[model samples]
Target: MQVSYIVALLALLAVTATAQPFLPGTGFLPLGNLRTTDNGGPYNISLLTVQANEIKGGLAAKQNFTDKDIVHFLTNVECLEGLFDTWGTFGHGFNNNLTLGGPTPIGARKANLSDAVRPFMEEVALNEQGHALFTRQAGSDLPCPPIDFTGGFNKYFGAAYNLTGNDTIESKFGAPFDPFLNDECYLLSVLSLEELGATGNKGLTALLTNPVIANGVAGLATSATAQATVQRMLLWERRNNTVYPFNETVQQVFARISALRDSLDGPQMDDQGLVNTDPRTIAVPDYYVNMIPTDVRGLTFSRTPQQLINILTLGSPDGVGVFFPKGLYGAINKPTGFNVSASGLDSFPSSGAKVASQLSTQQIGTLPGPMLPPNVTGELDLTQSLTGTLDNGTAATRGYTIIPPGMPYFSNASQVAVAYPLQTGSSNASSNGSYAYGGRRFF
Candidate 1:
């Protein structure tokens, strides 16, 4: 019976895959009618190799695991996987449409993009399936939530740009939110999603207590993080490789996008037609982008699972409820703890040059975005920004030191969250508590 249902779902997905090109203000018919909030809902996977029959029972049934931790992990994984599959499909469809090499059904002109971009999307699409398989094999039973592509895009871009149509209000740069209609928009979207995927994967790995399962989960996270770095490098190279009207660097572009919220002073859209001609400042707020470029200095940020879910689901109740509907997220039980750090004061390169430029020409390099922080060796200090206490008096400090490969050294101090009552700091003055963990710092 399960086999039959899987077959039927795949067939439906295949049929819907042929739907017309995506247009702003339009909604694509979702495949399964299963409510995202349901417990026994259908898993959104169809590669045949990952048929639902192979899935183990829910992770909460796993041996030697606490019920609360398992439930929380499963809930978060379900939401993350749904978003991954949806993002992959969105990317796949966009790339497939670009291959049409003509005017699309939505009136966007299509041209042959660089060879690098297409294969990247293809790999990302397939990689998402691997993530789905990983979650299922780990005994996650959460249902796959449908992705509202149009709504999701609007929620993201409308907040960032104050316009959502295809070259309607302004014709200078084409559609502000339509990736299919604009190549720059497509690349930017790719960079953003890939980076978010990497962060989400890494953050989730820390909470996986089972060593056996943690190995696989960590591998997936590393892969996602590597892909994100590659996307960042590519974005930088693509911009430098070509001359455009706004021949700006990646940092400049990021700055412009970050400035979009000055009009709103928050992370929601105003929609009052107060946009300016700078092409970056919007009348609304982009909580996601705004959160990305924090004003804090010398430290990088990674969202806890709940924080990320809020961004992915468009602040909740407005989109799929993968993490909501009682999946298990409370103030005390965050999906994962914060753990970020750097080697020492000398760990950051002295010149503040981009990470890519410091590497040997033969060595692979990553951009110095918040996703990958500077990792060097010297006297280290946790920045004031990453440390604090929550409104409820819970210690807010959590992070891992970012360091280069083979260095494997992070002698720094952090203030552990107060919820862990057993924890005692080595000192009360400048040092709190210092610990070391094993892993190659990809930064």
Candidate 2:
């Protein structure tokens, strides 16, 4: 049958179903006619098919969304592409400069700590690249606009580090601050990026319609959250081993970065361009919810395309910023809500037998100086970070006592293994794909 016929059949079946929440006016957002003709083109159809299968395997999961809502969603995808690209670029630069089994740079690698930082940085780069690719595949019209990673870093870092105008990465750490040099500094910066992505994906996932696409997007968001949590765990571990150079706690630093973003971005707006008086505190529906914990409870913390635009474009109404390009911003309707499968929402799967042990302590050695006191306990309770309860109990949160050995969700092989532990039977080397693990592998 033709694709249109299939879509028509699906629509007909959907309409015939009783009490389905999909509204009467719902339609597919036009993927063509984007703000710019710069998009490479539609993503690989095979990949889409794989994504569709993944979604189906993940189980069936839609909304009164209009063409404008679709536009808003696409626009958000474009912005995410740019943001993740910028972060990936920064991660590469950081990994290279750190001399972590990569190219050399102007300054010395901080404390010769290649092993600790390089792998994590490289993983982050790949994960970010995957995110950007998925965003494009999902339905992005515009190309990733140019972003000044250095300038954006300086702005955020300056706020968090209390650095003066003259003080820069080179001035403070013997290298430019944009890509970062200090190990802790890189950790903190990446931490913030991962957290932003994690939360943003949660909100965006709720807005999706296709179950396959929704599952793919939710996988991206879950990886981001897992990465962020790992960063926090590592930072805490470092702090505990000795009096590290940085004085602030992980929570304090993350809060400072968020505050800087809010202060610079101004008032948050919803999909319909309505002013959000309390953007940080606003609630989102249980669509594509994140199973991991966050600061808020009772409501999923959400950021609409407009809010993302505000922060990424640095409050530019026209989507133009010194660091971000104007074309990156697409018109969005005022903020709205959508419905998704409450039971089948995105969640991090538990660990596997290969590395079932909870993240334990290790001596990371001392830094150059003892700027702060050691945290021998290393027992900073991130339980609060992982717990939130909704008012209506539509969604519940799961907290972890320690970081897992591997990233979670369906975005990766290890994650797939963990997500569908029942599929962990013996296999031949040639049979590499996780067909048992919900058919997540696209190829």
Quote the lDDT for 334 in model 1.
Answer: 30
Clashes of 2: 15
- The TM-scores of all predictions, comma-separated, are 0.40, 0.43
For 1-443, candidate 1 gives per-residue lDDT tens digits of 99976875565355334322223332221111111111111111111111111111111112233533443343344334334333433532222321113111221223234566766655655665666556557665544333333344435544443443443212443323444433454555555455455544544454456776767766766776666555555554544332132344433443333333222111211111111111111111221112222112211223234334444543443324322333333221232211111111124322211111111212212223353334421102112111222221111100011123222111211211111112244222123222222211100
**Candidate 1 error regions (>4 Å):** 1-113, 162-176, 240-301, 317-443
Off by over 4 Å in 2: 1-113, 159-176, 239-252, 262-300, 325-329, 332-443
Error of 1 at 47 (Å): 47
Alpha-carbon lDDT, every model: 0.33, 0.38
